[model samples]
Target: MRIFLFSILLLLAGCSQTLHINERYSASGQNSRVQYIVLHYTSADLNRSLQLLTETEVSSHYLIGDRTPTIYRLVDENRRAWHAGDSQWQGRTWLNGTTIGIELVNQGFYDTPTGRYWQPFAPAQIEALIGLLKDIMQRHQLPPGSILAHSDIAPQRKVDPGPLFPWKQLADAGLVPWPDADAVARQQALFSASLPTVQWFQAQLMRQGYAVPLHGELDQATRNVLAAFQMKYRPARYDGEPDAQTA
Candidate 1:
């Protein structure tokens, strides 16, 4: 009986071993594991949104509901969430490893006889989102311009958090960057005089952190990416064709 008890104790100890490590120093040359925040709109109500994000194969770090504008932390920030599937940003692919995703409950868009109609976000929802964004940015020590729309990172397939998302409000809140009207007007004048070549547009888009092709052709994929940028910066029109304004 003594020997059996000793063996059981040994097994228990093996199962519950702990490790101790030194914490005398910190590194100054390293940056944060999280580099970007991707925003999305869940095309469902609160209950369906909860079901999709929590009980399915998809998930995000946070979800903002529209009815009460409640913020839900579906997943912890210390762990990876499956929100950004097959996503890329600024030359970094597979953004799920390095991005925090926030989904807002919305109906997204629908088509009518005239054209497509997008659902506008409520003031309360936007307010709640701004508060949540500030908290996340502060806690993660993220810099300005670290937020991106789902289409911005995955333009080829996704377009949630669409054009009516009030990006200017975010810029005003210092959460993202806004273009200088003077600089854009100057460039627009130059482009008006002589528009840039397709290759030039491709190069510029690549520099803007999109994964565009450099083949100098106005292909569909390139146009899709351009449309993504246009929707964010110039919501008046975004037909995916290069224009003086787009330039």
Candidate 2:
């Protein structure tokens, strides 16, 4: 009877998960919890950024200011930050769990009577960002080019970290990949003569880690995805249309 009662107590303790785990054994197949780092623009100044991120349900792991380029850690890295909303990448959805989000203080864009104007990231801010990214990537042991723009994860609904976000800077810093200019020029000449089909474009974007459709139609959704890609690669023009440059 005493043995059975003791067994019952042990079973209850196991069920409760109340015992301290042993640290002697380690698994070789486990990866870091952080697989990607997402960049975003707060679309507000420092004061408003704090208010918005703190007052609302929206939050990020880090927030960088523009003027002095101050770095703020609003959310701990061990915890999930509510930054990537309705986002997906590499077939993984709801990236708040496996990603770290960093928000930059910028107004994003403004639509005037002439056209839309995007805000450029400050130089000091970019420098600070590079340092911060290095620290995070070092700590997490993340691979190069694991950084993603918010639009890359959710092209349909979000466009922050827009055209002026300077992806090439990240690429130059060895944080992201940049296309070969010569290769792009040659491809441009060929595409300018004869643009590829919608199916081909869809396949290429999908190859570039975009969740574009393969239905062989130029739908609005597909255009949005293309626009997101263009915004990062070719910032001069991103009308979401399949043209020679886009091709």
* Counted clashes in each candidate structure: 0, 0
Best by lDDT: 2
lDDT by residue (142-226, candidate 1, tens digit) is: 9998999999889999988988899999999899899999999999999999999999998998888888999999999999999
Quantify all predictions' global Cα lDDT against the true fold: 0.92, 0.93
| Tens digits of lDDT, candidate 2, 188-229 | 999999999999999988877788899999999999999999
Give per-model TM-scores: 0.93, 0.90
Q: In angstroms, how far off is 205's CA in candidate 2?
A: 0.9
- Model 2, position 196, has a per-residue lDDT of 95
For model 2, what is the error of residue 181's alpha carbon versus the real structure, in angstroms, after optimal superposition? 0.2
What is candidate 2's local distance difference test score?
0.93
Q: Which numbered prediction scores highest in TM-score against the true structure?
A: 1
